[model samples]
Target chain A: MNIHEYQAKALFEKFGIAVPKGAAAKFPEEFDTALSQLPEGTTVVKSQIHAGGRGKGTFKSGFKGGVKLCKSKAEAKEVAGKMLGETLVTVQTGPAGRKVQTVYFTTASSIKKEYYLAILLDRATSRPVIVASTEGGVEIEKVAHETPEKIFKVFIDPAYGLADYQVRELVFKLGLNAAEQKAASKLIRGLYTLFWETDASMVEINPLITTTTDGVEALDAKVSFDDNSLYRHPEIVALRDLNEEDPKEVEASKHALSYIALDGNIACLVNGAGLAMSTMDIIKHFGGNPANFLDVGGGASREQVVAAFKIILTDPKVKGILVNIFGGIMDCNIIANGIVDAVKEVGLKLPLVVRLEGNNVVAGKETLAKSGLTITSGDSMADAAQKIVKLVA
Target chain B: MAIFVHEKTKILVQGITGSFGARHAQLSLDYGTLVVAGVTPGKGGQFFEHNGHKVPIFNSVADAAVATGATVSAIFVPPPFAADAILECSDAGLDLAVAITEGIPIRDMVRVKRAMQGKKTRLVGPNCPGLVTPGTGPKSSGGCRIGISPGYIHQKGHVGVVSRSGTLTYEAVWQLTSKGIGQSTCVGIGGDPVNGTSHLDVIKAFNDDPDTHGIIMIGEIGGTAEVEAAKWIKANVKKPVAGFIAGATAPAGRRMGHAGAIVGGTEDTAAAKIAAFKAAGIEVAVTPSDMADALIRAAKAQNVKLS
Candidate 1:
């Protein structure tokens, strides 16, 4: 659901929010052409990745920063050459880091001041909250924790939309000048529109800077859309970069299975989200690390279960597999039959433990017992988790 | 006495003609719930005949309520129209509207929640398993089964259960049932960030119901609803309360299948919630399987009888 900085800035421009004019290049050959589009000035070369902390990130090629301020067009092109196709490791991007597939070149702005601005749902109020702060270009959480008074929030009424007064209040709180205030108000309005119209989960601009000319602009844009509402906005969905995601996760999504890989040996397959999460928790509690979190959903059909098994087995680190189903409306017999068929198809050798309960549980257990597969059946979730952990150990 | 539903509660189904809705409708009918009406916007004047029970279908929630005298509605409309379905129930002034549909846009729910501010209807979920009050018959057959939960897993007794996840709720209920413990009512408030009801709402309801002696509250990472409910239980309620928080192993910023189940900040993490629960004197289940036993431990410490 997260889009790169360049993609977000493109969206910002489409929504009438001012962003520094930028062009992206996928190859070193395109770097000069991309730099040519920008006005002759100090250009900013940013490595395109989905994670934050890009400016402080280090590339695998021993290049200093993922984001660089080049003095000339040639320098920007050189920086872009160093970044493209290089892996960037940031605080957000784990140790493996994300490979830079694109590099963005933009006209660097002369900042008079920086302010933090974001729009997201405040879960407590169930309303969109505009979070702004005088302290910008840094982690907002750090600011909120250190100088709590610097942060200001304005919750907007979804029914009436964002009010003019709310924008004015944010502008005043950020201490914008008369010229900057007008621009900030308009920018905030546009940002909210982009957030609501595109079904964005969050729209954040770190260091929303005011140039020497008193014109306000989003210096850094981070926008993520709601996955559920993606159906309504095909344009937004088109921005999704499959390269940034794990291949197994992408494959799981294609199969309608919820899969998140972790660095462990015990793979967990559960029926629901909460159960899947807790299945991981219980594994850790019982002194076993979870390899992945996979939820087969309510209907765990034969094909879906088989697909889930295939996805889980892709992780060679997975030493054992645990199938936990608290099938309320789901037929346990169907799940058991699916497991039996999946095991035969995949020819699984790792220790497999299953705990099936609820509707038609007796038949389900009987099916597992008669499958001619060496599957361990546990009496409860605790028992099943213990069995798998022991088997893996 | 159950908090929201009982044996006498008349239930209506929205989008009953759909496969998902019809399937659960048949299950509810099999469980002996009084499924009085179905609403499918132009499927009016038709009957949803299942197991010899010919439930009438209406064009609108208003007509359905008027014709069938239904007080509650279980919504199974698709995400795009689910919010509108909830709004229809609110306009018709139904007592409760349990939205069983998932994947509703947060924007729509925000507007729906705001529009229903002072309305008569109490919304349970836009992505939930709904509520169940177990019957006294075999496998608890005759009780009010509003949503998609398996009725046979429940037993009519004194313990009250509330959870964010559907299967986890069933896990806790099954654990209790296996221990010969019965529940007064079990409610799933859904796992969306912006749901109709909160843990605090259900906790307060359970606290007021005299028949509900012990409580099992199941929550996950993300949001402070569980913390709020735990704090309230510490202050006002004398009932024995046991709590379990999932997603302890969930990495931060990752959405754990559920739209709402994400570790956002320091305050909403599982560790923070568990600490809050412990601070409020609520027994915390170390694992999901220990949920029923944790409640029993709480009940024993408080000299309270749960069934």
Candidate 2:
């Protein structure tokens, strides 16, 4: 659901929020043309990736800085050349890093001061909260932890939308001048509109800078849309970059499965989200590391089970698989049959342990027993987890 | 003696004409619940006949409530119209509205919640398994089965259960039932960030219920609702409470299937929630399997007779 900085800035412009003129190039050949679109000034070359900490990131080609301030257009093009098609390793992007499929070039502005601003749901209030701070261009969490008072929050009433007073309060708290306050207020309102209209989960602008002309702008934009609301906004969904996501995860989503790959050997397949999470926790508690967390949802049909099995097998790190189902509404027999068919289809050699309970569990267990597949059945979740961990070990 | 529902509570299905709604409606009827009516907008004046029960279908919640005297509604409407369905129940002044539909937009829920601030109806979930109060009959068939939870897994007893996840709640209930323990009522508050009820709300209800002797609360990594409930339990409630927090192995910023089950701030992490539970004197289950045992330990320490 996350969009790149360039995409976010494009969205910001649509909402009348000021962002530095920028252009993106997917190839080195397009880099020169992209740089040409920017005004002749110190240009900022940013590697396009979904993760944060891009400025501090390093490319795999021994190139320094995923984001760099180039002195000229030629320099910006050179930096873009170095970034495009190279893998960027940021703090958020793990060791394997994200490959830079696109590079953005923006005109670097002279900043009088930097400020932090964001709009997201405050779960406690069930309301959208505008978080602003005087300290910007750095991690807001660090600021909130260290200074605390430097950070200010304004919770918006969804019924009334963002109030003028709330914006003024934020502007005043950030110690903006009259000119800057007017621009900040307008920018904040526009940003909130973008957030609300587009069904954004979060809209963050780190280092929201005020130029020497007292004009406020979003220097770095990070926006993520609410996945559930994506159906209403096809335009927003079109901005999604499939290259940034793991292929296994993408494949699982296509099959309506929720899967997040991890570094362990024991793969977990559970019926519900909370159960899937706890399945991973129990595996770890029993001295086994979980390789992934996969939820086949409430009604685990045979095809979904087969698809899940194929996805799990794709992970060579996974030495064993554990299927945990509390079949409240789901029929346990269907799940058992799916497992039997999946094992036969995939030629699965990994240790498989299943703990099936609730609704027609007797038939489910009988089916598993007669499968003649090397699948182990445990009496309980604990028993199943223990069995899988031991077999893998 | 259940907190929200019982044997005589009249239930209605909102999207009864739909496959999902009809399927669970049949299951509820099979479980011997008094399914009084169905609401499918245009399918009014029709009867949802299943297994010798001919439940009337109405055009609106108001019409359905007036005609059938149904006090609670189980909503299985699609996400787009689910909010309107809940608002309808609120307008009709129903006692409870359990939303079983998932994938509702946060914006819709936020507005629905705001609009229902002073309303009479209590909303349970938009992506939940619903609530169940066990009956005394074979496989607990006569109880009030509201949503998609399997009624046979429950047993009529004193312990109250509340959870965010459907299967995890079942896991705890099954474990308790396996140990010859029975539950007074089990409630799933749903896994959305903007749900109708919170852990604190259910915990308070369970604490106030005279029949509910002990409680099992299963929460995942998310909002401060669980922590707030634990703190309240520490101050006011004398009833033994056992707590289990999932997503201990979950990474930060990853949504674990459930829209609400994501680690955002430090306070919402599994470690943080577990610490809060321990600090509030709630027995924290080390693993999901130990949920029932953890409650038993808490009950033993407090000298509570949970059935």
Q: Tens-digit lDDT track for model 1 on B1-307?
A: 9899999999999999999999999999999999999999989999999989999999999999999899999999999999999999999999999999999998889999999999989999878999999998999889989999999999889999999999999999999998899999999999999999899999999999999999999999999999999889899989999999999999999999999999989999999999999999999998998999999999999999887
Alpha-carbon error at A95 in model 1, in Å? 0.6
Candidate 2 chain A has its poorest 10 consecutive residues by lDDT at A27-36
For candidate 2, write residues A1-393 as lDDT tens digits.
Answer: 999999999989999999999999998888878878888879999988999999899888999899999999988888788898999999999999999999899999999999999999988999999999999999999999999999999999988999989989999999999999999999999999998999999999999999999999999999998899999999988999999888999999999999999989999889999999999999999999999999999998899999999999999899999999988877899889988998999999888999999889999999999999988999888999999999999
True contacts kept of each: 0.88, 0.84
Q: How would the docking of model 2 be graded? A: high
TM-scores, all candidates, are 0.99, 0.99
Candidate 1 segments whose C-alpha is farther than 4 A from its true place: none
Query: Chain A alone, TM-score for each of the models?
Result: 0.98, 0.99
Local accuracy of candidate 1 as per-residue lDDT tens digits, A308-357: 99999999999999999987887889889999999999999999999999
In model 1 chain B, where is the ten-residue run with the lowest total lDDT?
B125-134
Off by over 4 Å in 2: none
Query: How far does residue A8 in candidate 2 sit from its true spot (Å)?
Result: 0.5
